[model samples]
Target: MNRLQKLTALDTRFFYWCNDLHRDLGLAPVSRFVSRLGDGVLYLLVGLGFALWEREQGVIFLQVGLMAFALELPLYLILKNTIRRDRPCDRLSGFRAVIKPSDKFSFPSGHAAAAFLFATIMSAFYPPLAPFVFILAGLIGLSRVLLGVHYPSDIAAGALLGVCSAVVALHLWELI
Candidate 1:
């Protein structure tokens, strides 16, 4: 197989490996919950909490976080629509995702992007929360793979996109 084909094969193998863990361990429920958390609500709540309770730092975080998401959303939408890569569950026969995906294409997982964006912005403002937020961001990405709604590469791309967006936002806001 060519390099691209080999990468695709690896992605499929990794997906099955994660799926086996999800199935063998009965982790669907937990995966669903974690995935749901990455659905943008938590990010809003985090921003709101900071804005309402944290004073100046909170306001700055809110602004930077909002900017990061604003940048990420359009890029994410464009890439997903342009690439139009099929989800593993959609492409692979005899496989159905544990939960319905939010959209059709899955080149870059929106959930993973948003989660990592939130984690990056949160870490920039509240350094103490870095470990927890980054860990949660990673879990959100893993949850997408476990639920079979996204390929591992999709998650990786989304994560890289997210971190880049946040870094840009931070720089724009003069916070980094």
Candidate 2:
């Protein structure tokens, strides 16, 4: 098999194991709740709340949220269109995905990206909360894999991208 095929094959097995573990741990409800909280509306409200509570922190939240979307959305769109990786649910031999994926492509998970981006941004603002946010993000990322909606590599890349985006945004904010 080619490199990409090998990668996907590995991911398929990894995700299957994760799915089993999640099922064993009874993570369905928790995953669903976390996923719901990851939506744009909740993120906006949370950022606004932070902004209201602490003006400077609120600004950082707004900036980070905007920057994350600015970086992630376009990349998701482009890669989804270009890579067009099929969702595991669609494949007959693939793991039976718990969640219904909207699109066919499943290269880099938007959920994973958003989770890490928010965690990274929030950590920057409140260093004390770094561990909590990262742990949350890590759980969110694993949820995607557990649900069979994303490969482990997909989450990893998304996280890396998120970290890069957050760093860039912070540097840019510092300049302005």
For model 1, what is the error of residue 155's alpha carbon versus the real structure, in angstroms, after optimal superposition?
0.3
In model 2, state the lDDT of residue 43.
63
- In each prediction, how many residue pairs overlap at the backbone (N, C-alpha, C within less than 3 A)? 0, 1
Off by over 4 Å in 2: 1-5, 92-94
Worst 10 residues of 1 by lDDT: 167-176
- For 53-75, candidate 1 gives per-residue lDDT tens digits of 98898998898998999999999
Model 2, 1-176: lDDT tens digits are 89979977788788778788898998888887776666557667778889889898787778777876798778777877887777777764835777787788887777777778888888888889899889988887777777777788888877877777777787777887
lDDT for position 48 in model 1:
93
The most accurate candidate by TM-score is 1
Steric clash pairs (candidate 1): none
